[model samples]
Target: MTRFIEIRNGRVVTPSCVIEDGRVVIAGERIVRIDRAAPPSTRSETVVDADGRVVMPGLVDLHGDDIEEQFAPRSGAETDPTTALATADRMNVLHGVTTKFHALAFEESPEDGRNLENAARLARAVDRGAGALGDNRVHARCELADASADAVAALIEEVDVDLVSVMHHAPGGGQYDAESFERHYVEDRNWPAEAARSAAEERSGMDDASQGQRIDRIGELARRVGVPLASHDDKGRDDVETMAAHGAAISEYPLTLDAARRAKALGLATVMGAPNLVRGGSLWDNLSARKAIEAGVLDALCSDYHPASLLAAPFVDTGESLSTRVNRVTRNPADIAGLPDRGRIEVGARADLVIVDPSPTPTVERAFVAGSEVIRASAGSGAAPELPARSRTR
Candidate 1:
């Protein structure tokens, strides 16, 4: 039997919105019909009065590093990965993120043990959290030329890896010149002189011939896995062109306007950090996400390192309305990722919806996933669920 959930008396917001008294009919986790009136033949099973609230489809987050934040709430500080992941998952779901892509990258590991352990732990936690009553998915952004490709392939084959990318952060090329790399290492990462010197000493051995061979091998692996590949921090048109030729369809955080322009021209979806849009510019002093959105080069906005930014982004506008800003993070990312089934309130789409009440300031009132309420106002009434127990491990 097809179950029906009738959401009536709300403004259904989408790419095009309808501010009217209406009913959204959900039949077996999919919206079967949306009409201004209830059908005469069948009585609605569940009726949720929206009270004139704005009812919209749940947001889709293509890329988010907030797991890193929850794991390491402070720099050089570590906590239980599972606990952190669970907390982050609840926070995101409550904030209206129905589909979240948590990119777990293993970088700067001199030994393979720590990287492997972290990846396994993250994969387990994501699986648990997603299976729980939350919105989360692990998108593994594996560095192709950084780690042994065999180790990475094993990870892909073993774990629930969704999205993979070919990233080459080696110095003196791809995204950073030698000078920029030095600045990023010494200044940004706060690496000591000896550590930075040791890392650079190894990269100094990679010649163009060897780099080309490595790139080709990585590209071949991506094709073999049949996973969507992305290029990170594209610096120029040539870099975009090279990656596109290698079958990468997404360019993440293009550092220069020229790079972004070339990516759009090449029919690549450009993803920018929402923190960059919220903060007004890039932390690395590169091209601003807001600027790219305003210029019409940016297609999607990811949470990057902050989960709350995804909720806060809908209220932001780059000289456009709030609805427009919301679309960039919602419908835009979904379309770019080729996920047309979700991200909208149209009939036949998933019945994931979020209701926001901005009486005083913007706040998420309630959130639902296919007629299941995940968050309610009772949490604010001091009946909040207990925080999960933390387990200790390295």
Candidate 2:
């Protein structure tokens, strides 16, 4: 007498195409059956009438540092790791993210948090809070210019991070020039003018020689841990090549089109922020994610800082099939991040799924994680749903 959840009358987006008026059956932690027509009547099953909504695989967000923002919303605001992560979990689950790689930055920021000490603390928090809502994992954004690369390496060993990305947030290279770097801290992040200028000067003065050594050390550690290594904000072909040489299988947020193309040519998956695509451009005036998609250089989309952007990105109708667009936020990222179990909505895949009502905009009606009802919402009128609005995701 096994029990299962049967969802009928939904537009199921599969690996190849969308099945209109499809029925998906989930038993235990796996999707058991899927068809255009319902199977035999099972008295043991709980039926959820989707009422002509869209059922897609849950989003796999590979690089969202929203947890960091949640922990410390403003400059002085400080919430504990557990509480902040719990808040982030509910937010991510509500937005259709079944798996979240909590990208925590390990760098020397002007802020009190976001340094090596605090980032490690946050990583521990993430490790402790795994599955607090969704399949939460850590994605370490290791800064190449950090004073102690050893400490950064130690953080990776401390927590079993799903992914590791090396970055150099300096004025001379990567995502910023000297002026833009200062402008970013001042105008964008709202840092004081003098402080931003000082930080910019300090970063620009970082030794490039040390950066090479840091890359080698951290890259070797990542290899030993068998975690996927990524390079962040690649500016050009040379940057892509260099990081690739040091075991960067993924190139995230390539600042220029040429860099993204180079990453693709070098067999590195390129990921851009969904907010970049949805908001029409980059905040840094860097590479355009829409153009990257047009050129066929982009492989995946991440939430970056905004969790809501991930769910709505694939639904913006970018000339690609709905399946194709959906995969950009789902299957594509899960595959890149070495998570092969839970991205697709196939029969054997893990039941990490989302039901969306796409009217004025896309809204996640219900979500499941590992066959668990993380979110339960009524599609049409009152249906006596079981879960609360802030339920977790698969």
- Among these predictions, the greatest TM-score belongs to 2
| lDDT of predicted model 2 | 0.85
TM values, all candidates: 0.84, 0.94
What lDDT does each candidate get?
Answer: 0.70, 0.85
lDDT of 1 by residue, 161-261 (tens): 55656566667555566677767766755666566666666766777576556556656666676656778888899889988887778999898999999
**Runs in model 1 with CA error above 4 Å?**
18-22, 35-42, 72-81, 110-116, 128-131, 170-193, 321-323, 358-361, 378-394
Q: After superposition, how far is residue 172 of candidate 1 from its true place, in Å?
A: 4.6
- Residue 55's lDDT within candidate 1 is 72
Clashes, model 1:
0
